[model samples]
Target chain A: MNKYKRYERLAAIVKIFNDNPNTLINLEYFMNLFGIAKSTASEDIDILKDVIEKFNFGKLITVPGAGGGIKYLSISNIDSYRSFVKEMCEKLKDASRIIPGGFLYTADLIYSPSVVSKIGEILSYPFQEKNIDAVVTVETKGIPIAMMCARALNVPLVIIRKDSRVTEGSFVSINYVSGSQRHIRSMSLSRRSLKKGSKVLLIDDFMKAGGTIRGMMELMEEFDAEVVGAGVMISTQKPEEKLVNNYISIFVLKNMDEEKNIIDIEISDWIMGE
Target chain B: MNKYKRYERLAAIVKIFNDNPNTLINLEYFMNLFGIAKSTASEDIDILKDVIEKFNFGKLITVPGAGGGIKYLSISNIDSYRSFVKEMCEKLKDASRIIPGGFLYTADLIYSPSVVSKIGEILSYPFQEKNIDAVVTVETKGIPIAMMCARALNVPLVIIRKDSRVTEGSFVSINYVSGSQRHIRSMSLSRRSLKKGSKVLLIDDFMKAGGTIRGMMELMEEFDAEVVGAGVMISTQKPEEKLVNNYISIFVLKNMDEEKNIIDIEISDWIMGE
Candidate 1:
């Protein structure tokens, strides 16, 4: 091989690792492949892992076992939700993620797999101890964590859509506050989709004012189903103000918008390690 | 005992099994917990497996040894990508999911660990053979798959926001056709994100006119980065129309639009055993 370029060597290393998802690779092989030292191969993978993570493909697990190698497990963070919310609180301390309408787009907070997994563990904590009829959540973002929690608890999910489609069959309507300042709002879910009297674990993406959860509660009532428990990806408000209590998820920092529409941010109770 | 509900017993069973992660539950204890015949306890678990799988929860596997009762692992159907995608395609076939826009707003599709896992598998395919410096994807819906894929490929994701935010430093601009047949549209990524000459693998939620991939390609050019591969969760147009040829992911359906507005769904060429 007339001197291989940096790109060629990088490609060769990736190919070797890709052939085995969880298999280990040694520096000896890469050194032979690229005629480079172990330091170069190590440097290349380090740079590559950083770039790939930014793409959201996954994280690289570097193992130092007897047969050490890189193992990839699609994890968010270890107990991602917990650590993520913790990270969010720090971001909140910067007070930037605040969206208009007094809501925090801690959607990034939802992205942490470790946090998501931990929250899944927490929400499922109660349900895993019960025979859950099904997991219920509104359409859209909440589906991810809801699905995870529901899976952990071993339940079916009944996702309530905001707009009922023709195929969904007869619809039931419910009223509750939605988006910004808890304005009264209404949405629809097909009655045919939910089984009557089935226990439902209500879920949503976020609860700033807690209106959507209240709305889902009403939707559950319309279907004559019981609200067994509720889980959310994040909650930036107080639990007492809402109809539900002690329902769990992650919380970064809480901030309030005051005069001139300025906001101050701080971490919520969950990520304080409580 | 005052007779706990089926959920109560199921929860107990799950807790006992899960506390061990992969431990087996004995039949003698099953008979004691439900106070029912060994056959009845066995039947209940069989039903629960179907229910749990829907949530991407682990399965209640049976072992045939004297100590075997039910062995539960934390593994969801999503533990592997190929099988998970197959499961979602089966769910999409339901007539109830058909809707307007030729778009499938599969909230379940997004959350199903198995589905996402399969999506991860498909997206990671091309990049597996190549050294990927990063995983790049637009935000909102595509985040999960991007995140999961990043997780699998041991990479970090750099998000391309639809609108530029305050934190984004320096920027690269690009344009492409939109799914709605809209003429060349622009999307941006933070300049601080991708380094020069880094190899990027683009991913997105759905592919229609292939504008997003095209846009990403243009962005890669702007950054002087090499485009390794591109993947879509669902490709709605004819494969030939895909601007990026070196790609792999699912082929949802051909076209569901104007003139015809008919729906035709196909599993990704990969999951189809291609």
Candidate 2:
């Protein structure tokens, strides 16, 4: 095998880290692959550490001792995330996006892979250090965003179905009132979806009265799982208080006038570090 | 600003390409970002090209014209993809994954980020050159796989909801038969989800008679979109005649004796280039 150059090794290392984010990798593996010694591997990692920091491409965390290795945590600077949210707010402000039921049409934004992946990265950043075992969401709209968040955090995604399906085997179902609609709805999750006492982060595409997320939290109780954090793409400002506390929303919908065809949305104060 | 070393620039390029796969990024953008000359950027690309090929990460294509730039197309070697599918088959052959009513419980595998992302990459590889405008899938199980496929193809994801909802504004709904259960069901897509005359790739997690995928194909007709291709993670073998044709399935379920607790699954022959 031909020996690889430092730049070539560096390029390959970046790609590997990018491919498997939040995954622990042993230096010996790279040492063997690149035919390099421990000293060279350490130097390459040091250079990569500086490069990631300079570009705000997240962090490369190294642990010492046995059963220890390096892992990549994908986090972006506040400004870039803020700018992305601002662009989303601008797109959402379009009056044409309003539906008949006073709801904003956000499917376009949430469904786009490029857009939602960034949303996922931003939403999952805060909970990266929370030791989350899984990311949870309800069926339908939240699945994409939640999936991306799960991908970013390097965790499994557990989706709670709106209605019980026969295909999922044994499941746990619960009925909760839809906060905005005021109708009791049932949600279900397979018994095998989570292990007991697994720490999870909840994610959703949109939130209004916080009923859905609260329902998810309650559903977590059935599995004896803990909800470490909750995140939504957008939440209305009318309900200053939500059913659950300590949740994050990327955008706050302050007002949407149906007749006037106007919408006032902004990046959430929490995201802006206010 | 401090001058970046050649290796540092190579590392940054790999990270950028990984972040925005299939995106046409201009060389001027890199030059501006790194304060490097055109010749230096060319040398870096040459090195990255060699590194990516050696690592089997993917391809970095450079277009040489005013409207042309460089884009990353994520494609793995056939052996790697075949091995991934083989591993999936091994996990799936476990009798415990069988559920009542003869359905396989695949939520855990389909919902996994790492596993599903690879499935997405493999599924989207063939369609990459087709200029697919979006990846389409029905809601629930297929969303994660479809979303990752869209990510890999660098296109938007359009999810067809099983039931029409008020939040999506105007939508076109269609009723179709579920091939496996032979039950009539309705699927809907928002009017604004796809542009007219766009080319789309249909993806799903599993198919028996392929009724759901056929339903998606019919729904695509309403928007005047062409179905360029279709892919599924797994398809049953007994249904030799499927509702849809010209689709790719990564795995073929040869037999599943529910009473005997046996599942014989294998990587699809096409993937192995049989």
Which of the numbered candidates is closest to the native, going by highest lDDT? 2
Candidate 1 lDDT tens digits, A1-274: 4255444444344433432333346667667766777687788678656643543333556768667866433332334445545655566444454454444544444444434544555555545544567678775556556655654554555666655432344678777767446567667776656678888888776776567887888888888887777777566654446655646655523446633444454444544544
Query: Which pairs of residues collide in model 2?
Result: none
Please give, for residues B1-274, the per-residue lDDT of candidate 2 as tens digits: 4388888888889998988888899889888889988888888888888889888888989888999888898885566677788788899999998887888888889899999999999999888888999999998899999999999988999988899763677889999999878899999887888899999999999989999999999999999999998999999997899998879999899999998999999888878888
Predicted model with the maximum DockQ: 2
Q: In angstroms, give how far residue A152 of model 2 lies from its true place.
A: 1.0
DockQ of each: 0.04, 0.85
Q: For candidate 2, lDDT tens digit of each residue in A1-274?
A: 4398888888899988888888899999899999999989999899999998888788899988888889998885566577788778889999998787788888788888889988999999888888899999998899999999999899999999999873678889889999888999999998888999999999998898999999999999999998898999898997887888869989889999989999889887777888
For residues B1-274, could you state the per-residue lDDT of candidate 1 as single tens digits?
4254454455445434533433456778877756777777876677666655644554567778776676654444333455656666666666555555444656556544545654665567556536677778875467667766654454556677664442343566666677457776677775656778988888887776677777778878988989888888777656456666766657566545434534556776545556
Q: What is the TM-score of chain A in candidate 2?
A: 0.97
User: What local distance difference test score does each model get?
Assistant: 0.60, 0.88
